[model samples]
Target: MTLLKLTGIVKTFPGVRALDGVDLEVEPGEVHCLLGQNGAGKSTLIKVLSGAHQPDEGTIEWAGSTVQFSKPTSALRAGLATIYQELDLVDDLTVAENVFLGHEPRQFGFSSRGITRRRTRELLARLGHAEIPAGREVGRLPAAGKQIVSMARALSHDARLIIMDEPSAVLAHDEVENLFRVIRDLTAAGVAVIYISHRLAEIREIGDRVTILKDGRTVAVNLPARTTPTDEVVRLMTGRSVEYVFPPRSAAAPEGTPLLRVSGLARAHEFSDVSFDVRAGEIVGLAGLVGAGRSEILETVYGARKAAAGTIEVDGKPLRRGSVKAAVAAGMGLAPEERKSQALLLGEPVYRNVSLASLHRFARLGFVQRGRERDAVGAVTRSLDLRPADPRRTMRTLSGGNQQKAVVARWLVGGSSEGGSLRLLLLDEPTRGVDIGARAELYALIRSLADQGVGVLLVSSEVPEVLGLADRVLVVREGRIVREAPASDLTEAQVLDLVMAGERAATAR
Candidate 1:
């Protein structure tokens, strides 16, 4: 059956047409993938379907009948559920309470807590996660655990169609495999799924059909997900023949002292005995599975987390442990993994966020020189090609890719003319939730920064990204460096094998 159909979906916002005549269709028991770059209208179309926003012009057919959803509740009641990239669960709520939040069972005018917990447990078991305690607070669970809870909540509605936006972004390899298993089970039961992700390989693995959107309009509809060439899909989404290619490494030898040196770094239970050095104009990458301490290592080096032992030296000067201020003072800039929470001030203006790291330069007598600050930020942001190109716009209004650019631009503003204020840049999963097109731009930008003689230390879950972008590759597993080699000496398969071998060995022990 044609479970859901959207035709000519036109949605507009103030000074922007978010979706311009978009179309989509989902069938029972099929995984329909929606592919688009950021700002390509995927989010707007999904919001329209979920009733978060009403389309200015469009036709929606649900179960062969024309229908309109005015609110999220109405859409939920109509058997449509959406799981946003940022989860909606309340941190303080229990798993059971979150699962049955809006529609808890009532007994004699009282909310039945027992019934909610029992039902939530059952749902979790059905979704292949019987271990998550129903009474535990949602905030206490890890990212993968939270995702499973979100899935249970979606199933709580008896939803016939579920929309998952970037569901695997926070999940590791094994967790993603588990998610795929759950998705397969959902589709086997005749439920429809509309999946969204930036990882093209995933679309081939789990998707049945694909619909490509570009610039607020549907470019191609109902293309075979697995058989469609990846390059063709990239062209459709980006309007250009773009390959996932990394820039050539600079042949010029790095001059001057090592920019960053970590001597026997240890973080108690996180990572231990980790040591590495990055030279000026060099890019060093850490490749490992999620939870293998890649992010932890970066955080420890950045002084966000105190190292139990060992020292971090920048330009031959040791940094004070656990002091972000000290790290910043030593010319270190970290674009953390969680950009929204750790790096960006969402409610602040673009120029303010971009100028955050360099505020001292713009300050005089406890007053900021706004004009100079704006001009400096504007120059860097323009070079990054940040969208909207307006310094006064709120950071929350920008897309994921643009927000990331702003974070990088923050370090670029008002730095030394010789090497900028940043001598070392630490990037943790820099392309986590960004689209392919934007990823290309970021890759180029990172190379340009390295070319300017800034040493970069990167951590990425994707092995190919690490190998392609880094001059030297460090393979970390189970909180230890398993192998170290030049990026040219390793392939993706070799890195994956090393990582998996560690996993198997750990399991045996």
Candidate 2:
């Protein structure tokens, strides 16, 4: 039986018709996968369903009766729950508090903290995560643990239908398996799931049916998820074949000295004896599972963290340890993983954010030359194909992809004003929260930067990303470099096996 149906859904924002004549149907106990490129109205449609936004024109039939959700609480009461890509848990609250937020059980008109903690523990156990302490702060948990807490919250509401937006985006291979198990249990209990993800491989594994949306409209509906051809799905979502092709590696060999060289790099208790060289026009990728020290290695090299022992050189000049200023002075740039908190000034205008690193060049008598700064920022933003093409807009208003572009554009414009050029670029999880179309563009941009003779050191959890974009690949496991090979010499499966084996060994020890 159809649990819910939406017809002729039309939702419009001030200047954009976000959802135009969209339609959807969901059956109980089925995983209905929603497939779309970024900006394809998936978000808008979900917002409309969750009562965050009301459709301008539509008919919603719920359990054989027409209904409208006036607010999020109304939708929750009607058994609809949404877990966004960025988990909506309150970091400062305890696990129990976050799980039962807004609907805490009461005893004699008083919030029963003891009962809440006990029930939270029960819910965690039900979700195979009993080890998570109910009283522990949500901020203390890792990404995977936070995911479990989010799921526990959905179950707390007794939701018959749950919407999961990119739920597995942050999970590792094993964590994804655990999530699939949870979804299977939920479906067996007659709950429906509206799943959204950009990973087609995941859809094949966990989805029962698919609905494709494009340019604010549903292009196809109720296709067999497992059997549908990937090419067909990509074409539907993007209106093109959209092959995941890496830009061709330059045929010529690098001829000059390495732009960046690290020897005996070690961050005590994090990584040890790590060594690598990225020459101009080369991309070196580090691939490993989360907590395997890939990001820590990058951070230590970028001078964000102190290295207990190591020698780092840029163009034959040694950089001072644990000093980002020294690293930048030596012609190095870093685009960190957590862009929002670490790299971007959210409330500042795009021009100011992009010009942050290069402000010294536009400064005279302790004052900024605003016009020169704007002109330089505009050139870099345009070169990166930043949308809206306006540098005056606040950084927070831009999408994830655009924010990342602005982060990269900062380095492009700043590039060591005291030196000849940007010798090396450190990128940590460059495409973490970006969409498929934007990923392709970012890949192209990274390659273009390499072509301009910028040495690139990249770390990504996705093995394919490392193999596709890097000229050389380093496999990190248990705070050590377990293997190193040319990108063409390694396969994704081989990399996974190596990483898993290292993890298993660490666990055994």
Candidate 3:
């Protein structure tokens, strides 16, 4: 029997037709992948199916009956569950509480703790993940562990259809394999899985069929995963020709004084015995899965994280250890992963965010001179081409891409004043949340920074981004720096392999 079917589904967003007459069909015990770029209608289609939105016009037939869901609760009642990229679990609640949030197991006509714990354990065990203590707070758990809890919660609804958006995005490679196992288990029991991801390799590995959405419409349907190449999928999603394979790159790094070097760096539970250097005009990528200690290693270098053992030197001069001030003084700047959370103060004005790092120079006696700050902010705003040209708008009010530009403007402007050239720019997912056009500009900026003798360390989970942007790639796994391969010599499979084989192989040479 057909599990679900949608025909002529349409949805429109502001100034964008997010979905236009899309079609999809799924069968019982089949894993279907919804493939597209960030702005593509994949998100819209999933939202419609999961009852987050009402399609303007469509016929949804499920379980041999035509139906319409008014809201997510109705969809859940109809046995459809959605696991979003940002999961909707309450951090303050317990794992069991989050799992059975809406409907709790009550005893004697009242909620009972003992029954909830038992039910939570049973569901988690079925999912092959029972390590999540029912009593422990959800916030205390790591990201990976929390995802398992989310999955458990989804299963608690007894969903006949499960939609996972970017399931393995933040997971280690081995963890991805484990997820595949769980998926296989679910499908074996005659349940359907709707998967969405940017990682094409995983789509090929686990998906039985694929649906391609582009420009708010379904371009192709029921494409066999085995016969269809990733390049074809990429072409469909991007609507442009892209070389799936990389060209041979042969370019020597800049031969100059070491811009930034760390010796014997160690952070507890993060990284150990880590050391490397970025030369002038060099773009080095730190590649690893989440929690492989890649971000912590960079944070330690930037003095954001305390190091147990390490020595940082800038241009042959020793830096003061364990101090962000000292690292910035030594001309090191970092754009962290959580741009909105870690990098930008959302409530502040755009100008304030731009001048945050170097306010002292624009101020006299610790009093910020508004005129000087405005002029400095204006110069960067025009250079970066930020829209609205509003100096007074709050950072939170700006769109994602523009806010990202503002954050970069902060360091780019201040870094220039600290030194004529940008000394070191450590960017974690710099092009993240930006549009394709903005991404190209960010890449150009990185290249320009490198040309200006700024040593750049680009950390990203998106393999193709690192492959495209970095001159050299250092694959890290299990808190140690693994193989160091030039961009020309490196391949996505090779980097993923290193991440999969963690700790035991722990590539040291």
Enumerate clash totals for all models, in the order shown: 3, 0, 1
What's model 3's lDDT at 292? 82
Q: Which candidate, 2 or 3, would have the higher TM-score against the true structure?
A: 2
lDDT of 1 by residue, 1-509 (tens): 69999999999889999999988889999999999999898888888999989999989999999999999999999999999998999989999999999999889999999999999999999899999999999999999999989989999999999999999988889999999999999999998999999999999999999999999999999999999999899999986776475888988656667888899999878888998899999999999899999999998988899999999898888989998888887778889998998889999999999987778788899999999999989999999999989999999888888999998888889653223478888999998888888888899999999999889999999888999999999998889888888999998988888888756634432
For residue 23, what is the lDDT in candidate 1? Answer: 87
What digit string (tens of lDDT, one per residue) describes model 3 on residues 191-295? 899998766778889999999887778888999876797668877877555523332332667787778888999988878988888887888999888888888
Among these predicted structures, which one has the highest TM-score?
A: 1
Residue 407 alpha-carbon offset, candidate 2, angstroms? 1.4
Instruction: State the lDDT at 243 in candidate 3.
Output: 28
lDDT of 2 by residue, 1-509 (tens): 79999999999877778899998999999999998876788888898999999999989988888999999998999899999987899999999999999999999999999999999999999888899999999999999999999989998998899999989877877889999999998899899999998788889999999999888999999999999998899888776675475788888766678888899999878899998888999999999888889889888887889999989888888888888888888778889988987999999999999988889888999999999999999999999999869999889767677888999998888787564357788999998767677788899999999999888999998788999999999988878888788899999988887788856534432
What TM-score would every model get versus the actual structure? 0.96, 0.94, 0.84
lDDT, model 2, position 190: 92
Error of 3 at 66 (Å): 3.7
Q: Native-vs-model 3 lDDT?
A: 0.81
Count of backbone collisions within predicted model 2 = 0
Cα deviation of 391 in candidate 2 (Å)? 2.2
Model 2: ten consecutive residues of lowest lDDT? 500-509
